[model samples]
Target: MLIETTAWGKLEIDEDQIYHFSKGIPGFEDVTEFALIELEKSSFAQLQSTQHESISFLLTDPFNFYHEYEFDLPDTDAEELDIKDAVSVRSIVTIKEQLELSTINLLAPIILNPLNRKGKQVVLHKSSYLTKHPLWAGNSILDKGGE
Candidate 1:
């Protein structure tokens, strides 16, 4: 299928690669379907909405930046995605930029089913997590051999 995107321009996307977010993201309830487009050889990805060409989000694997990152989903969410094991899940963080400070929303991670291409953005109930966690903070930890 051919889709027009603001970031990647018009591109070909496999029908199977389209992910259906039944509940959509926090603010994008009406925008459900999306395609995860990798940005060349970079670690970043663009989650482009299939329904709306104007709606898109820059995402990245939270674990790559934050090794200690951990979150437990409610039973309802796990059941909704039909998650069987840990390997079936992929977590992504939404990126945000403000002047010199860039941030990622770690508190609400978008979980995807690699096998079926189903996805959902889940909000962590844990108080320890922050919505605007600095992605660069993990670099300092890695520099200190903290992993």
Candidate 2:
């Protein structure tokens, strides 16, 4: 299947690579189908909408930045996506003037059950995490290659 993406142009992806999000991402409730495009040599991946060319999100493993980052995955929400145990957790990233100034959205992480190809963005109601937590202590995104 071919999908038009804003960042990657025309992309050919397998049918199984498409993810169905019953509740879509926050603020994007209309788009529920997305394809995860792996970025070159980087932990970041493009969560591109297969329906809209402009609807795409840059996602990354939050643990790459905040190792201690942990949150609750309510059983109720997990059951909705049919998530039993294993999960693919990723956080949305907001790039600033420079890559070194980027911030990760640890407050709400996207959790996906690959076995079912279903996902949901769970927002932490009361938590210390932030939507724009600095990528690291200081200038580490470029200094350490975001490792």
Candidate 3:
């Protein structure tokens, strides 16, 4: 199938690439359908909304940078998404003018049931994870900017 997007324009994709977010993101409740597309020459992926061209996000696997990153995996969420196996946990990333200044959201992770193409954003209620975690080890973890 082919879907038009603001980020990537029109492109061919498979049905499996489409992700359904029942409640959508925090501010995007009306836009649910989206497609996860890999970015070229980068580790990030685009979670592009199929309905709204302006509603999209860049995501990345939290473990890629923060190996010790984690949050409670509730059984209720698992049951809701029917996530039995092949779970894809990704975090939303905020890109900056400079690549190294980009930050990723660890407080809320996007969980996916790959088998059923179901997806949802799980916000950590107990953890101290911040919404804007640095994507790289910016200057000995002291500086507020890029790595």
Each model's lDDT comes to 0.74, 0.86, 0.85
Global local distance difference test of model 2? 0.86
Q: Which candidate, 1 or 3, would have the higher TM-score against the true structure?
A: 3
Would you give me the overall lDDT of model 1? 0.74
Which residue ranges in model 3 land beyond 4 Å of their true spot?
139-147
- Show model 1 residue runs off by greater than 4 Å: 86-100, 138-147
Residues 36-107 of candidate 3: C-alpha lDDT, one tens digit per residue: 988888878999888877778999989999999877789999998998768999999988887666788899
Task: Supply candidate 1's per-residue lDDT for 128.
Answer: 77
TM-score of each prediction: 0.83, 0.90, 0.90
Backbone Cα, N, C clashes tallied per candidate: 0, 0, 0
- Residue 110 CA error for candidate 1 (Å)? 0.3
lDDT of 2 by residue, 3-53 (tens): 998877898998877899987888999999999888889999988899999
**In model 3, where is the ten-residue run with the lowest total lDDT?**
138-147
